[model samples]
Target: MDIQTLRLFTHLAKGLHFGRTSRACNISPSALTRTIQRLEAELGEQLFFRDNRSVSLTQAGEYFRAYAEDVLQRREQLQLQFASNRELKGSVSLYCSVTAAYSVLPDIFQRFRRGYPQVHLKLQTGDAAAALPRLQNRETDIVIAALPEKLPGRIIFLELTETPLVFIAPTDYPGTVCHSTNSEQEIDWLQTPFIMPDTGLSRRRVDQWFAEKKITPHIYAEVAGNEAIIAMVSLGCGIGVVPLLVLDKSPVRKQIKILACSPPLVPFSIAVCTIDKKIRSPQVQAFWNIATSIENAYKKGPTPHMKNGVSKN
Candidate 1:
């Protein structure tokens, strides 16, 4: 019935968990239940099917979720249009990996804060793999992510930097996984224990690399975040592939060593990505412009020096 109500519904639709949605929306579980009940009563239809163990959207809920998202997006646009002359206000949610938050966003945040003090930046950090899906779901306005091989049509990305994907092994562990092999051909891929990403761009790239080499990897573990992979490798779990940027920023950097491969893994083009419509919001546009300016500055500036295969500006 109202913007807040619609927001709650849409967020719940995405997560499909009453407890998480209630906590995120800053409402008590009882209040959230009452709110949904009120909405269902008003609409004369059940929106979600809830049981003790699971929650799911009904057919009506799916249609209403789409409607709610459109309405919320349009409201943001309308607000932006009406307040053209006023100071830019409203929040822009951002999603990125923890490494990106530390390495990539500081300059952009500093500039944005100085220019638009009234605007709020809500940052959420997790696996880089979730960035695009969260953006598509309208959960976040902007994301710092690696540019995928084939970008989705609904999203726009601005390249910020490029980082090589490298293999890493434990420095202290002199196990079979960390054995010194002069070249890719010398190593026995079947016997080597390897840590790999469970999903996302890096995972696909690694998969392709293995396929081209015509070798089935001896996977030790499948982890979610690159940070986690670094941690596991540092513990002598297995050699893992991760972005050089992530490795450089990792706390256990000293515990890990980069391994040379015959054919190096393709580098990742890190970028800021957002849906086409969200970019049109005034606050979101301001953030994008700041990122754009930074990107342009980097282009015009001297090339960053390479430190242990990581670029340093």
Candidate 2:
């Protein structure tokens, strides 16, 4: 019922760990539990499913989550309106794949920082599947991911660009198939070893494409992170399947070449994922506007396409 309790629940839902949420809010674990318990008791419903080691939102918890955000957001807006705006302030947390963190986040952060220096930006990187539940739970305010379709629940999807899936091989390597953006002959899947993202989204797309040709990838290694895939290809581990953006001024840019393709593999979309935007504060709104600018200036992000994190060691 209280705003502080609602905010506590929101963070708890995102972390799904009472201890972590308590740490994040700078409160004790017992206090965190009591706050949620009070709120749940007032609502006459359970908000979380607490197991011995972990927690998850129940069906009723999920419903409470939406209304809780609404309440907290409205309360914040009222406070903002009453205060003499001394410059926009507050925090915006974001979760994204490694590529987006590298290639996509810099300018957005730069512009956001210049406009409202008081606003805090907290960035975290994870795979596509891991980010969604965090957004749903309000752990982070924004998410950047490469996905084929829509998000679940009240999350809002903001499309940035449709990126092509391209193959990359080392420059000194002699395959002679990857130097150009186009190809005339069928790529020999049998001869080449593949380096692929370990996550489900990339695996599914690659699997479906290979399934049609009745060709199984000769994977030399299954690596995590886009930079490592590119680095491994440089050391001649295997050719990698990654978004084209990763190749643009990448760390080992000169060392790799983009492979030729017939029709190209599936094009994954780059988008800014968010909790319902309307509930976002004015400072958050301002940053969202800055992020929506699709110009090449803001196009490159923080991690720039390493599947999970940007690199593997």
Candidate 3:
């Protein structure tokens, strides 16, 4: 099979969703199906088992994923070796949260673009909660996200920087129970209305805090993104939890105040994560090297918490 068809199969194997794979590959659904069918016929094995509701890789398909990845990595490496010394040309797809895009990407992009002008950089932004899933699904080549307390075994991370997970409340409007205070007793966390994250590392951390404190949150809303939580908190809807870097870059930074809890939440490690196999590609390695190099320079400068598309404060 041709390399392009191999890529399609690989995406299908990872995604298990025809529609998502089609969109990501920039092909029509019919064409994607045809490509997969052609691949299956060539191999005399069905790559995917499809039903009305779900799609999954067959055993043969699982084995081929490793083969496809290896082949693709070699192809890219060959191209890189033969290409001119002056320029590198290829595409790198990246996924990150909106806040990370604004706060950490500027430095990386500035340096990357200057060195590899011909590279086509495709950036996709969304909630931090989706970062790991998208990377694991092979939907993106790289992801900027917070490292969970128990990181998955399949992923490897180049830790960029760290930010504190702070409690925020509205400064202009005071609530009966939620207010700006350093003491745990001064603010009734259990009784206070909270704008909580619906999913993500932040949500898990929050849950841990609540469990340890033996306090149940009076959740006002289950927000999907940190930005949304910040917005709700600014409206005086309730107190919320967010990374300090997010709060610092927020347009409504002046409207909210950071609270001090009795037991400070563990800081978040902002990082660029990728599967172990993907790093074999020359393009991935090049970018990873560039990203890791930024940490030292980042530390010597103004904010020690920011680097490698990650921030902590």
Scored by lDDT, the top model is 1
Error of 2 at 201 (Å): 3.4
Reference-based TM-score of each model: 0.83, 0.72, 0.86
User: What is the per-residue lDDT of model 2 for residues 167-248, given as tens digits with 9 covering 90 to 100?
Assistant: 8888877663322235335566666778877765566777777788777777788776666777888877778877777667
List residue ranges in candidate 1 displaced over 4 A: 12-33, 48-70, 178-185, 295-313
**Where does the lowest 10-residue lDDT sum fall in candidate 2?**
304-313
- Order of models, best TM-score first: 3, 1, 2
Per-prediction CA RMSD (Å): 5.5, 7.4, 4.2
Point out the worst 10-residue segment of candidate 1 by lDDT: 304-313
Q: What TM-score would you give candidate 1 relative to the actual structure?
A: 0.83
Give the Cα lDDT of each candidate.
Answer: 0.84, 0.71, 0.82
Alpha-carbon shift of residue 77 in model 2 (angstroms): 3.3
The true-versus-predicted C-alpha distance at residue 296 of model 3, in Å, is 6.8
What TM-score, to 2 decimals, does candidate 2 have? 0.72
Show the colliding residue pairs in model 1. Answer: none
Q: Which candidate has the highest TM-score of all?
A: 3
